[model samples]
Target: MSTPALTLHGVGKRFGDVQALHDVDVTVESGTVHCILGENGAGKSTLCNLVFGGYPPDTGRIALGGKDFRPDSPAAAMAAGVAMVHQHFSLVTTMTVAENLLLTQHGLRLRRQDLTDRLDEIAQTYRLRVDLDQQVATMPVGARQKVEIVKALLRDPSLILLDEPTGVLDPAEIDALIDTCRAIAADGKAVVLVTHKLGEVARVADAATVLRRGTVAGGGRMSTTSIAQLLTAMVGRTAADLDPTVAATIGLDPADAVTHRVGAAPTSISGPDAAEPRSITTSKTSVPMGETGSTASALTRAPIVEHGAESVAPRVDNESGSAAAVLTVDRVTVHRADGSTALNDARLVVYPGEIVGIAGVEGNGQSELVAVLAGDTPVSGGTVTLADTDITTANPATRTGLGIGIVPEDRHRDAMVAEMTLAENLFLGRLGRFRRFGLLDKQAMGRAAKAELDRFDVRAAGPWVPMGSLSGGNQQKVVLARELSAANLRCLVAAQPTRGLDIGAVDFVLTQLRRAATAGCGVLVVSSEVPELLALCDRVFVAYRGALAGPVETSDPAAAQQISELMMGVAA
Candidate 1:
């Protein structure tokens, strides 16, 4: 093909002692979608950063159209016709969409009128629509992501790097993104997508590369590779020993069930950002650790699920009085602090010993529902009953007291205080009993925190260390341990619990949630990942336009397809 659009030879990167990427080689031709697939810390992001110049590679050569290419910064990369759309948005939450759009161009060169006109022109040209005057903070997650994509496209880069861009998008929005990439490729641009979601890779990738432990495992023309082959490559397993997909492809075989194998100390790997690479922390809680590839880890890590995530397990109705619901919401309505209606008569129920899911496009009332259930938000109407007690007006503390535990959507903002010690944050809400004679008992709290953290196997400098000192997965472990282990925790609500976690952490969190349900806690899992919801939830409900749809049983073979239609505003 006419000189590959981008190429790397023997590229390597290191963050301190972590070798994030080693001898990496990749090439992208124009007019194609090249997918870089890997588990978290598999060096995907490091490669992207290497190419984008967030940090220079430790060793390597980069070429653009057969010419020497080296960039000192992201701006220089963009100047060379490369743009990156990060996983998390970088927009000014306070700015109007139109303003954000205009700021990218030369300052003072375009009037507001000109910017609006440009937005309109691009909307028509790209077949993408966005509200120009709306504050990004108020837009739905899907819309905000669309704005991010538009921001990257506005620069008209010849090569685009998309990092987990569809993590928060709905099926329709994801399809739109794929179509846009195709349109861009048709115009001879190159698209490099770095993602852990195997289904997306199977659907949109023209060529694929798999990374494991910062090294390329295998890759080839997408047409020549089967999903099974891709999974085998990504997880370092054989077709028979292949695990999750192997089970799903035939049928879930408990005898064949597998978990992550024990991996040693944190190695050099790509992490959350360019400055810091990821590290591994072994949790030694009571829970049995899985092999190198645990069932949950393998399933979430690979494209094992036919629909792209794990599918249903038998509903476990093992709680006392199993038929009785632990939590119920009747016609709940919620308004945002900004005065926008968030949930309109949203309703659902969580029965003991069962996992229920709230599935929808991001920004479609899932967050509000979680807040309302967690007692963090005030309701405008409707009633929430916890074990037959009216809790609509209960405060967060009251909810917690009534056995309502939440692993909030934003763990940092709602679940834990980053600046506080891990012990302090773990026992933050339930500190009343720790006080003795109106005086705080430091020794008692320390002992309790250490015992509890050790039980959850949360690795940290010590219980005295800041909560933020741990990795994302370990941080999540702290949350899961606290909530699930709470006294009289009859029900638990977790929102996007695995949102930013790696496969190892994802597996651990899901396992904990399941065990909590098995032990009689009603569990509510709110996530944008349909595959996850399909795989783990016993029952799934679609949240759309601030409303809850049918509670589809996950046991149905077509559950994923049905959920997709419901999320897209169609009745399954």
Candidate 2:
């Protein structure tokens, strides 16, 4: 009898206070896609690390090809026919795609031309497209992901592990990735898909393994298992707890109501791929896993209505000619990477005491709008007024000074200085308040920062710890601590504020944003999560190619459906 591609026997791991993984058992069949589902810290990475020689389990054992597989290092794992594409790319930014692919080769030296040609052949076979000569740093996220996958495939490994493969990809890119995965599986390789999304499990998983709090909850064929059962395992909560109102009755925040899930979970195990996991392509695609698919189809296929600006942009700030709106963007047109208009005549008015959402699929110019409004991007043609102050041409510092705070989409890029201490980060933009008579007042800043950090429930060693030391949720809280605590904060623009946050942090952030809104701060939330918009926004505007659609009332029952339609460019 042939051995399973991989096997775990009562695997357990520990790191001082935390048991990262415990009594975990898994079996992956060759030529099949096996999905390992879990919450953020549910030991998914720990389990993968164990298999990849990142670390060894304290108890039990792992076997590859029915043999004891205790790898000494990641290199040893790769040497033993295993390759992994981690959530974070490990490519050398200075090198070209062809160069990065061949860097790890031991003695098999090939000319540059030969290497490029080989890469091209592999890319063509897998339907993965990447520039051969372009530097890895120059590639977009989706393109870079393709390069990583192709590089892994170049090795022709028997076992491939993808860790959150589609975290940064757009929808079309996601579809392409899913197809690529299917193609790889078709080649009879064993694939371990680690993700938090059930939709991906529903669509492409041949087998599903649920991990809850460091242990295997259950396992079954995708055709036989249910999302409810899977979500229950990962979250330690039932499907009924997913509904905000239902959970609210039990005293839970909307964000906390759902466990690690971003959107909602599928009621049953059904979608595009409900059959036994088979090659999606000759239709192979890949994504990290499901981005969670409760609203996946609706969001991707949401009707897109392309009407003139006169149709969508009908709201006036005030009929009496008063500056009633706290934040007003009129006829904003921001450019794209290709120098096309990303925000074409986009108009909106975010008044005090209202939480407004900009909802759409990823990359419909939400980043451009955030940049332009945050004063990071120059407006090509538009007038942005903040409390009647025309700051259209103002720089970021100037706008920030005028009471506009931004929680950018990519927090590592726009929000915090990773190397700086938590206290230093907390008082980053507003250091003057901490300044003493003749020099920097470190004492005052530390005291104030510590106070706020505790108040915000940021789990940190201390204010002296660098911002990078904290987890995603804690880091986000620190960012929020800085922005929301600003004395003159009037208008807040948050772009995907909860993208990678855990449930608790998400709850805190959402609650704070709502609190800010209640305090009469004009808040603009730009997110791709339909449920988030519907849950928090008083009114939601769907963005399509820089065009802002209806100010759909959240009170309206069809708000989510309408927003989804607008995201897909449908006239509702």
Clashes of each: 14, 21
lDDT per residue for candidate 2 within 232-306, as digits (tens), equals 566544533232312221122223223322233423434442322111101111112133333311111111112
Each candidate: what lDDT?
A: 0.72, 0.72
Q: Model 1, stretches more than 4 Å misplaced?
A: 111-126, 237-315, 318-323, 336-341, 430-471, 556-572
lDDT of 2: 0.72
The estimated TM-scores of all candidates read 0.78, 0.76
TM-score of 1: 0.78
Model 1 lDDT per residue over 1-572, tens place: 48999999998888887788888889898989998887666888878887888988888899987898999999899888899989878999999998887776466566788766766766776677788889997787778888987878777788999987875565556667877777777778899988665556655778888887788777766655544445556664422332232232221221222221112122222223212211122111111112211122113222222212533343355443547889999999998877888899888888888888898877789888888888778899999999979999989888888999888878878888899998788887777868999998888988888998877767676889898867666899999888887778999998888776654455557667766776778999988666566556778898988889988876666566567667778674
